[model samples]
Target chain A: MRYTSFTSYDLILLAQGLGVSVALFLVTTLIGFLIGTIWAVMRFYRVPLLTPLITFLAELLKNSPVLVQLFLVFFGLPALLKINVTPVEAAVITLSGNTAAFIYVIAVAAIESIGRDQIESARVFGLSRWQILRHVVAPQAMAFAIGPLTGLLVNQLQVTSLISVIGVVDLTKIGNILNLRTLKPFIVWTVVGGLYYIAAKLIALGGARLERRLRAHTAWKGL
Target chain B: MILAPHVPFLLKGALLTAEACALALFGSLVIGLLVAALRTSSSPLLSRAAFIYVDLFRNIPFIVQLFFFFYGLPEIGIYIDAFTTGVLALSIAGGAFSSDVIRSGILAIDTGILEAAEVSGLSKPTIFRKIVMPIALRTSIRPLGSVFINLVLTSSILSTITLNELTGSAKIVASDTFRPFEVYAVLLIVYASLTYLISLAIGALHRRLNRDRMPDVA
Candidate 1:
C-alpha cells in the first residue's frame, strides 16, 4: 500500500524546510545589504569607472528574472569555470547578488533624497566627507530606506522560493515532494504558501518596527 | 558558434513569449480595471474582497500560485494545456499588481473633477468609464509600464511549468550544446536589453500621452 497519508514525520520535514528558507533569507539579506551599500558608496564618491560599471550591473540584475540568474549560476557557472558548486552555494551567490542589486537602487534613492544644501552646509561647517556622510546622510537615509528595504526583504523572502527549483530542499521543494507523494496539490501547496505568507508578514512587521524606531526622532514632540 | 544554429529555435520561443505576454497583458488590464474598480468602490465589502485578493497574490510568491493553479485546476476537472494555464496564472498575478497601480491612479483623481462630473448629470458608470478610467490610465502609464515589464520577467518562470518559452528554449539549447554558460549569459543580456527597450518605449508613450499636462504628470 502507498504511504499516501500525512504523518508526524512530515511536520519535521516541513520545519526543516522552513529553517533552510529562513536561514538562507537572513544570510543573503545581510550580505546583500553590505555589498549594495558599498556599491552606493562607490557611486556617491563618483569612482571614475566603477560607478558606471556598478550601475550597469545593478540594472542588469534588476531587469532580468532571478530564475535565469539562478540557472546561470547553478547550471552555467560550474560548467564554465570547471568549479564545484553545491546547490546551496549557488543559491547563496545568486540571491545575494539579486538582493544587492535592489538594495543598491534603494540606497542610492535614499541618499539622493537628502538635499544638496545639507551636504553643502556640512562642507561649509568644516565637516569631513566621512563625517558629512555619517552625521548628515546616513541617519536620514536609514530612515528613508527602511520602508523600501522592508518591502524588498519581504519580496526577497518570496524570491527564495525560486531556489527550490535549483534543488535547495527549501519549503517549496518539500511541498513538491509531498505533493508528488500524496497527489494532493491543494493541501500541500496551501500549507506551503501559508508558511511563506506568515514568514513574509513577520518580515514586514519587523521592518515596520525598525522603521518606527529609525523615524522616532522625526516624530512630533510636545514642547 | 554553437548558438548560431539555434537562433531560429530561440526566436520561435521569443515569439511564443511575445504572444503570451500580449494576451496576458490584455487579460491583466481587464482584470486590473475590474479589481481596481471594486477596490475603489463605495461598497465596503467589495473593496475588502478586492483588498484581500491583492494582498494574498502580492504577498505569496508567483511560483506557488502558478503551481497551485497548475496542479489544482486539473483536480477540479479543469483540463487546460500548459500554455493556457501559464497565461491564466500570469494574468491573475499581473492583475494584482496592475490593480494596485490603477487603484492608486484612481485614488489620485482630483475631487473637483469628480464633483464636476457628478454635477454634469453623468451616471456613475459613465463617469467611471468616461472620466475616471482615461485620466487614471493616462496618469498611471509609467507605473503600469513597470508592472508589465515585471510581467515579462516573470514570464521566464513559465518555463518551469514546461511551456518552453525563451528561457525554456534556452534550456534546451544549453543542454543540447553542453554550453549552459553561453546560452544563459546570452539569454540574460537579451532579456535585459529587451526590458530596457520596453522601458524606453514606455517613457516615450508616457510623454506623448501626457503631452498636454507635461512637466506635472511625469
Candidate 2:
C-alpha cells in the first residue's frame, strides 16, 4: 500500500509543529528583545566603537532578506568555521539575530521619541544618567514602542515560516510534509495559513491590550 | 576574483529579476490604485471588501501565498508558467502593501481641493484621474518606492518556484563553487546596494516631482 491517506496522528503532528513554531517564536523573541535593548542602551551611553558598529550591523540586517541571513548561518557559517550546526540551532540563531536587528531599530526610535527636555529636567533634579534613563525615559519609551513592537512581532511570526525552507520542520514544514503526503495543497496550505493568521491576530490583540494599559494614564476622561 | 567569473551568469539572472520586478511593479500599481480607490469610495460594501482583501494578503506569508497559487492554480486547471505565476503573486502581495500606502496618500489630500474639483463639475473618474491620483501618487512616491524595493528583495523568493532570478542563480553558483559564504555574502551586499540605489533614485524623483508645489518637502 502507498499509505497516502491522512491519518489521525496527523493532527498530533500538526499540534507538535505548532508547539515548535510558538516555542521558537517566544524564545527567539525574548532573546531578540534583550539583545536589542542592550544595544539601545549601549547607544544611549554613546559607547565609542560599539555604537557605530551596532548601527552598521543593524542597517545591513534591515536591508537584507531574512532568508539570506538564515542561509548564511545555516550553511555558510558551518562551512567557514568548521563547526556543526543543526537546523533548529541555525533557525534560532538566525531568527533571533534578525529580530534583534529590527528591535534595535524600533528601540532606538522609541528612545529618540523621548524629549531631550525631559532628560535635562531629570539632570537638573540631580539624577545620574543611568538613573534618568530608567526613571524618566523607560516608561514613556515603552508606551511609545509597544505599537511598533506589536507590528514587528506579527512580522517576525510570519518570518518564522521561512525557517521551514531551511528544513526546520516548523509548522510550515509540517504543512509541507502533509501537503506532499496527501497531495492536497489547497487544504494543507489553507489550514496552515489559517493557523498562522490566528496566531498573528492573537499577537496583535495582546499588543493592543498592552498599549491600552500603557497609555491608560494619558487617555482622556469624560468631563 | 571569486565573483568575476560568475558576473556574467549573475547579470543574466539580474536581467530576469529586473524584468519580473518591472512587470510586477506595473501590475501592482494598477491593482494598488484600484484597491485604493475602492477602499476610499463612498460605498461601504466596496470599502469593506477592499479592506478584507488588503488585510488577508498583508497578514498571510508571501511564500504560503505563492505556494497556494503555484499549487492551487493547476488544481483548478488554470495552468500558467512559473514566471507569470511569480509575477502575479508578487503583484497581488505588493498590491496589498502599496494599496495601503496609496490609500493613506489619498486620505492625506486636502478637502478643499476635492470640493473645488466637485464645483468644477468634474466626473468621479475624471476627478480621480486628474486631481486625486496625481496628488496622491506624487505625495506617496517615496513610500511606493520602498514597496518596489521590497518587491525586488522579495523577488528572491521566486527562486523557490524554479524561476532563475538573481538569488536562484546565486544558489547554483554557491553549490558549484563550494563557497556558500562568499556567494551569499556577495549576494546580500548586491541586494542591499541595489535597494540603496533605488532609494536614492526615489529620493531624487520625489524631490523633482514635489518641487513646484511643495518647496519645503522638495
Best by lDDT: 1
Tell me the TM-score of each prediction against the true structure.
Answer: 0.98, 0.97
Q: Rate the local accuracy (lDDT) of all candidates.
A: 0.95, 0.92
For candidate 2, chain B by itself scores a TM value of 0.98
Docking class of 1: high
lDDT of 1 at A45: 86
Interface RMSD (Å), each candidate?
0.6, 0.9
| Model 2 CA lDDT for position B83 | 97
Q: Scoring model 1 with DockQ, what do you get?
A: 0.85
The global Cα lDDT (0 to 1) of model 1 is 0.95
**Candidate 1 per-residue lDDT over residues A1-223, each given as its tens digit:** 4599898899999999999999999999999999999999988888899999999999999999999999999999999999999999999999999999999999999999999999999999999988988999999999999999999999999999999988999999999999988889999999998999999999999999999999999998879
What tens digits encode model 2's per-residue C-alpha lDDT throughout B1-218? 77789999999999999999999999999999999999999999999999999988888888889988998889888999999999999999999999999999999999999999999999999999999999999999999999999899888889988998998898899888899998899888988889889999999999999998877768
Give the poorly placed runs of model 1, Cα more than 4 Å off: B216-218
Could you tell me which 10 consecutive residues in candidate 1 chain A have the lowest summed lDDT?
A1-10
